[model samples]
Target: MLEKKRVQQLDIPSREGYDAIFNSNFLEDVPAALAQWGSSRVLLVSSKTLAAQHGDRIAALQSALGSHRLANTKLGVGSHSPYADVRDIARRVQRLRADCVISVGGCSYSDACKAACLLAANLAPDFTEEDMEALVDERRGIADARPEDGTPLRPRACRLVAVPTSLSAGEWNALSSATNARTGKKQHFGGWEGGGQPDLILLDPELAAATSPERLWLSSGVRCVDHCVELMCNPESAEGRCEGLHGHAERGLRCMLGGLTEYKAAKTRARGAGEKQQQQQGTQEEKEEAGDKERQLLLEGVSECQYGSREALTGLLIWRVPMGPSHAIGHQLGAVANVMHGVRLLATPSPSPHSRALISFKTRPVSNLTLPPLQITSCVMLAPVLRWQAANLSNPHYKTAQAKTLAIFNETLGWREASAADAVERFVRSLGLPTTLRDVGVVSDEEVRRIADKTMTDVWGGGKRQMEFDDVMEVLNSVRG
Candidate 1:
C-alpha cells in the first residue's frame, strides 16, 4: 500500500492467444475449427434445451464434418457441472474415442465438458466412483498448495472447440468448476498445467443473442460486469496507471458497458419488428434478414468482451490474478447449495433462520485481516485516490492505452453522479437481475461460514483479494436483505 513506485509487469499467456471467430454465422466455422484440430471423430456436448432450440443448425454442422464423423451428441448436462454428470460424459468420450469435443452452452455446460475432457485423458475409460473421488481430491489439494509446490495433474490431451451462447466468459478461461461428490462443494480445477484450456473459442453472437433473455443474458451479463469490475479494481491494474494489461481491462470495461446498452436497444427494436411482422405478414426472406440484422447488432456488443475479458481470463488461467470475494463466494454457493454460478454472482440468497442469527452475530468487522495486510489496508485507504481519479475524467493520463474507464461510467452509463458500486447496481437492476442474497434461495448461517472459510482456503487465481471471515460476513449481511 505504501509503495510509491513499483515495477510494471504484465503477462500474456502464449496459449492464451487462440483462434476465435466472432460472428452471427459462427457455426459455419465449426467444421473448420475441428479440421484444424485434425479431429476425425468429434463428440459434441450441449444442453437438451439448446439442442432443441438449434437442433437443425447443430445437425448441419455435423454434416459439414465431411468424411470426418461426429461420434455422438450428449444433450444432457445438468446445471453447476455436477461431478456425476462429468463422470458420465467422460465414459462416453472414452468409449467413443472422440478426438475432439465441441462444448456448446453456458458456463456450467462448458465447464462440464472441460472436466470431461480432462477425466477422459487421465483416468481409465471405465474408472470407478472411488477412483474419480480420489483424483478429484488429489487435484484439490495440489491446487491449494503454494504456487511452487502445486503442479496440477495433466489430463489426456484432446482438442476442445467452445461455442459460447452466453456472456459468462467461462469459454475464455482455463479453470473448470465441478462439485465434489463427497463434500458437495464446488471445486475449481484445470489450468495451463492440466492442459484444460480450450483449443478454440467460437463466439457466435447469433447464438448468444438467441438465448433466453432472462436466464442467459441477465445472469451472465452481470457475470461479465463482475469481470470488468474486478479488472478495474485489481491490484495489478494499480489504480489504472499500470499501462500493461490494465489498459486492456479499462478498454474492455468501456466496451462491454457500451455494448450492453446497444444490445438492449437492439432487442427492443427487434421485438417491435416482430410485433409489426405479426400484424402485417412478412416474407420468409424478410424474417431471416431481420433476424440477421438483430444478430449483427448483438454481435457488435459481445465483440467488445473478447478484448478486455480475454486479458482478465488469461491472467486468471495462468494464476497471475486472484479471484475476488464475489467470485469466491459464488463458487461456494454453487458448490455447497447447488446454486447456478451466474445466479450466485448476482444474489447470495438468505441463509436459514438459524444461520441468519449466526451470521448476524458475526457481522461485526474485525480489527485486522489474515493475509496480504498491506494490500487490504491499501484497498481501504485508496478510496480517496479512486474518487479523485473518477473526478478528473479528462486528465492527460486517461488518454493512454486503456481508455478513460471513469468517463465510460459517467457518459455511457449515465452514472456521472453515481458511485462505482451504485452504477453497477443500477446496471444489474436494468438487466432485471437480483441485487441481494435473499432473492435466489435460502442459505443457512452454517452455509455462510462454510462459504467464507472455503473462499479463503480454496486455491484459484485471485491472490491479491480474499475475504476474511468477518469481511465475508459483512458482504453477506449487506446483500442478505
Candidate 2:
C-alpha cells in the first residue's frame, strides 16, 4: 500500500535542474521567496487573460519588486509557443538585460520563456530566422550547443522562475517545444542541461483554480494520467535498469485517478446544489457562504490533482523515460491541426446540439452555439497503444510490462476487465471526456498521413519497437471512430 501523506509546503527535488515549491500561496509567499533568489531585474511573461484575471495580485507583485527591478512585462503569448513570439521575448531579454524571467501561465508560456532565455544566452545579438531553423535542424539543444571557440557555453545569464496556472506540468523540466510559424511545425528545444529550466517553481492550487477553465483543468489532469500510464507500460521500463521508477508511476496513477474522481463528484454535487438553491430562492448571504464552501471543496480536489501531476512528472523526468506514441502523435496534432494539448475526442456530440442551443438561448448569443470538433487527448490513445504493444512486440519484457500495467489498472480502478485499453476508455468516459479521432474535425486522409509522417520525426515517437508508418496508421485507425 502507498503512503497517504498529504503535501502542504514541500520542496520537490529535480534530477539535475531547478527547485520546486509546492502549495504556495503566490501573492503571500512569492515576494519573500524572490528575495532569496536576489534577482534585481525580473521580466514577467504571461497571457492577457491571466493578467486581467489577477491584476490586483500582479500589481502587488510589481510593488514588491519595485519599478526599476521589474525590468519589462510581456503579455499576449499565444498557444504552442510560436517561434516568432519566442524571438520577440528573446530580444526583450537581451535589450532589457534582465537577470531573471518569471513566467506566469500554462505550459506554452513556460516553454516560450525557456526557449527565449536559451536563445538570448546562446544565439547572436541579431540572430535571424534561418539561424533559429538551423539550431533546431542540427538538434543542438542547450546541452550540446557551444561557442565558436569550442569552449563550453557560459552558465545561463538569466534565471527562470515559473508560476504555472494550468496542470500541463511543463515547469518541471529543462526541455521545451516551440511552434515554427514559417513551417507550421512544432520544434523541440532544450536538453537536460544548462539554463533552460526554472530556478524556482511556485505552485498554488488556489491560483490555478482561479485562472484555469473547468474543462482545461480537468483535462490536463488526464494528461498527467497519460504520463504515469505511459511510464508504467513502457517496455523499456521492465528492464532492471529503471525498475524502481515503476513505484513512482504506480503511486502517481493512484493519486491522479483518486483526485480526478473526487473532483468530478464534487463538481457535480456543487452544480446540483446551485440549481436547487436557485429554485428555492436562497438568501444572498447564505448563497455566498455556500459558494465559498463549494469553492473550498473544489480547491481540495485541485490541490490533490496538482500533487498527482508533480508525482507523475517526477517519475518521467528522474530517469528520462521515453513516452509512447500518444505523446508523439499528439504533438503533431497540436502543431498541424491546432488542437489543444488536453482535448479528448468524443465519438458523439457532447451535451448534444439541441441542449447546447437551449443553454445558449438562455445565457449566450446564437452565434456561440456552434461547437468545434473534438480532438482526443494523448491519454485517450495510451490504452490502444498498449494493446498494440501486447500483440506485436514478441519480447518477454514487453509481455511482462503489459501484464503489470493491466494489474495496476485493475488494482487502482477496481476493474475486473482484461484489457487495459478498455479500462482507460471507461475512466475517460467517467470524466465526461470522449475517445476517438473522427471527432478531430473531419481529418482528411492526407492530413492523417501527414500527422503519422511527422510522428516519425519525434524523438519518442514509436516507443521501444520503433513503430513504422503502417504501425502508426494501425493505431490511428483503431481510435479513428
Candidate 1: where are CA atoms >4 Å away? 1-13, 66-68, 128-130, 136-152, 212-214, 239-243, 276-295, 305-308, 311-319, 340-407, 460-465
Largest TM-score belongs to which candidate? 2
Per-residue alpha-carbon lDDT of model 1 for 344-407, expressed as tens digits?
Answer: 2222233322111111111222332221100011111122223333444354442331234445
Model 2 score (lDDT) = 0.68
User: In each prediction, how many residue pairs overlap at the backbone (N, C-alpha, C within less than 3 A)?
Assistant: 14, 2
How far residue 61's Cα lies from its native spot in candidate 2, in Å, is 3.5
Best by lDDT: 2
* lDDT of candidate 2 over 37-88, digit per residue (tens): 7778788887667667668767776787788679899986766788888888
